[model samples]
Target: MPPPRQSIAHLAERQFGVVTTGQLLTLGVEPSWIKRQVRHGPWNRLHRGVLVVHSGPVEWRTHAQAALLHAGRGAVLSHRAAGYQHGFLDSPPRVVDVSVPHARHVAGSPGVVLHRRRHLGAEGWAHLVNRLPTTCRPDTVLDLLTLARSDDDVISLLCAAVRARTLPAEIRDAVMRSPRMAHRRLVLEILEDVEGGAESALERRYRRDVERRHRLPRAQRQVQHRLGDGRRVRADAVYDGLGVRVELDGEVAHPGGRTDQDTWRDNAVLLERGDVTLRYRWRHVRVTPCSTAAQVVAALRSRGWRGTPRPCSADCPVT
Candidate 1:
């Protein structure tokens, strides 16, 4: 039979190089033996009762596993940690976030954020990803809502999730399931905007402050076009009932200058279809929204749209 040390190492391999003292003891490894390894050998203590089984390097997974084990059984990764684990977050978290049953009290550890969940046992929202127990993706989004420092932070997370291909229905259903969610309305509104193909805050700003506020006709989103060279492209927004298409250029896409692809789509798709499009950036939508709305109304009028654009307020200049 393999020795207790070998047994613990085997178990740690399955846990991203994390091993709990209870696990070592269960394998018949004495406390003194564990001490010797931590004191003078390859292992390093991550928390009070958790240790890294190897000495090469401790990555995010290792830290995550150590946090989970340190929090004991029935704990799962949550919030930003789960976001990173679920492949939506761009970077590893500075502090590992772990969620445990509200009734369970795990001692606080350095570099770990503990979230107590009331329904973590029979109705717990957890599953395995990359071999570590974590909150479900939608639930992770909800957890993030509670922890986000600002509205922009929340929006950034949701946009990142959308970019990572998380279904809107899934997040919406999660919101529905959580009736008492703190940011429910804001999240739902943003989700609707994003699902309507407003991929950036700039696009959403146009949809809200410019189009809706000015009473412009509802525009189709992500309108796809098949070009001459068989290249399929999608426009940002298109007015179907009226012959107007607006191409939103956000900051993230080619920040320095416009792409040739945009020109090709504009000429081949918009002009050929006899649709007028407006090009606007962050400043136009955010700084001079009324002027932007006025331009859109003029474009719509050029396309034979017999609609009057309303000023957003008494002081507004949309007309």
Candidate 2:
């Protein structure tokens, strides 16, 4: 006889329509009935002993459920999978990443990446999303940082998480507490930059390439200024001594009319106050950073800055 549909449905509902064969057996379901359901009924097998309770399309949630079930007990969604669950990732993960105890040996599959961890049992690191166990937002950030391929990738993810308010205070605590994490020094430096008002990848790039790399003096970031009409504007980076302000346009696409007008108005006010502003785009900072730094150096020089620009690398265009 088939297992009671009502009981199975209740369990599947909580698990995104997925269930392990072990769960069914524990619920008094016969082993033969479980195989029969997959053989002839609406049930679809996702992994070894893991089945989707319905015949519908396998969505992201179903994949997550299957991965967790296949990893056995104490496995939680992690890395890019957890980033998606925390609403930081733009799309559903292509590969579901699940974390298991360091001592547990789980067979890996094409669609699932299993991570073995010795410290995953700590409190406040795991939470539930869609009834699936996942790393908390802070932990997810740290985990994703490890998987980042480049410094740009790390900055992009960190800025996006911070902008979306998904990154929590505990992220810093986690980073500082974990002495074994790879890229710990770089991660700490990026966190400090973000906390110090480098809120976008573009802004961070400008700081790294245009200012620091070129040996330009440190400028106050996100400096607030008030217009004659009481409108407040924040400059991306401001050199108070040189009266030179730098604006970073990070958007790849052109701005709308209103944004353009606001920029024009803000520029007019700043110009009236004798403050010189220079604007740089995303490509300017990332692609031809040396040339971009030269321009900034020129602007500062025009404003009576006596410091000379220095080359960051041997091939650096800036002299």
Candidate 3:
């Protein structure tokens, strides 16, 4: 090797910089060396001392930069940033949020959102160690709930949170103890309605929108018609002898890594119950109740059960 790699830049190509003053000194790169590098366009200064080596695609460090700039010295990225890292949100947040322990609120910047919590639980908060835009899952869930626009939005966020087993008990407690949350009757109802697990919420939402809205008869959830110890496949919704079974189709229901797996499962359910099964989607349940009801009624009529969905204010808006 040529002279045994003398400097920090020589050691790492895309360096996030030395973690401390001591590391910088150990690397024999003084404050002058950093300044000279930046001045010569060898490194980009992200914060006071954190320098990133100029390289191909230095990553979208919006959150880390905001955290470093907003929280001053020792703030590691957490909450929404962490959520992003953990793959919770589908899109990156427009504003980078930083959590500082102090009570001072820094004036806002164009893309910086600073949060000061007096006491964020340190136990679970250590997940962000050495990670940019990192946050504990609990805090992330709470932030999503606070920021989500609609009940469906909240449901979507919570469903993900629940699936990840990251929805904290503290969040549940915070919702229950808050007097203000009581005013949001729909949110409260949805929150209370979340039982069993994330799959349960998906099932419940499908039942509420598809079965209850269309005046379809209630189908027993997770019913197993199979005999003892034989890995009974649970029907999502079972009408028993009423000639209808509603199979709530979620992503987990299809496991072959193919869309055809879903079709096969639906067909299997239908064939098992003499083709009386009605399948519904997770997202379109609320919005497409009319079409879903029409399908169910058509199925019922084919089985010699005459019934029509009553026209109501719930008639879907023409889209």
Alpha-carbon deviation at 251 in model 2, angstroms: 5.5
Worst 10 residues of 1 by lDDT: 1-10
* Stretches of model 1 off by over 4 angstroms after superposition: 1-5, 28-33, 55-57, 149-170, 189-200, 241-244, 249-260, 270-277, 281-283, 294-307, 313-317
| Error in Å for residue 81 of model 3 | 1.6
Question: Can you give the TM-score per candidate against the true fold?
Answer: 0.81, 0.80, 0.72
Candidate 2 local lDDT, 1-319, one digit each (tens): 6567789889998888899888899889999888888999899888888999888889999899899989988999999999888777878988999999999999977699999999886888798887889988888888998888888888888887887686535667888878888677877888888888988888988888788888999889999878777877778889987888887876632353236655775577567678887877877899999999988888888889899899988888777
Q: Give the TM-score comparing model 2 with the true structure, all chains together.
A: 0.80
Looking at model 1, the pairs that clash are none
How far does residue 147 in candidate 2 sit from its true spot (Å)?
2.1
Whole-model lDDT values for every prediction: 0.83, 0.84, 0.57
Q: Write the per-residue lDDT of candidate 3 for residues 1-319, one digit (tens) a residue.
A: 2212356555443224323333456666556665676788556554454456563444546335534554564454655665666666655666667776665555555455677766644556635433453556656666656677666667766666665665545457556645464224554555555554335456767767766766776667766664333434556776656667776665554433336754665566566656466666655566566677667667666676655555445544311
lDDT of model 2, residue 28: 90
> Relative to the unseen true structure, what is the C-alpha lDDT of residue 287 in candidate 3, on a scale of 0 to 100?
59
Top lDDT: which candidate number?
2
Compared with the true structure, what per-residue lDDT tens digits does model 1 show for residues 1-319? Answer: 4346567768988888888888888888788888988899999999998999778879998999899888987999999999998877778999999999999998999999998989886554789889889988888889888877766666777887888777888999999989998778889989987876778777777888888889988788778877667878787788886767777776666576568877777777665666666778878888999988888888788778888888988888777
Please list the residue runs of candidate 2 whose C-alpha ends up more than 4 Å from where it truly belongs after superposition: 1-3, 26-41, 164-169, 226-231, 241-244, 251-277, 301-307, 310-319
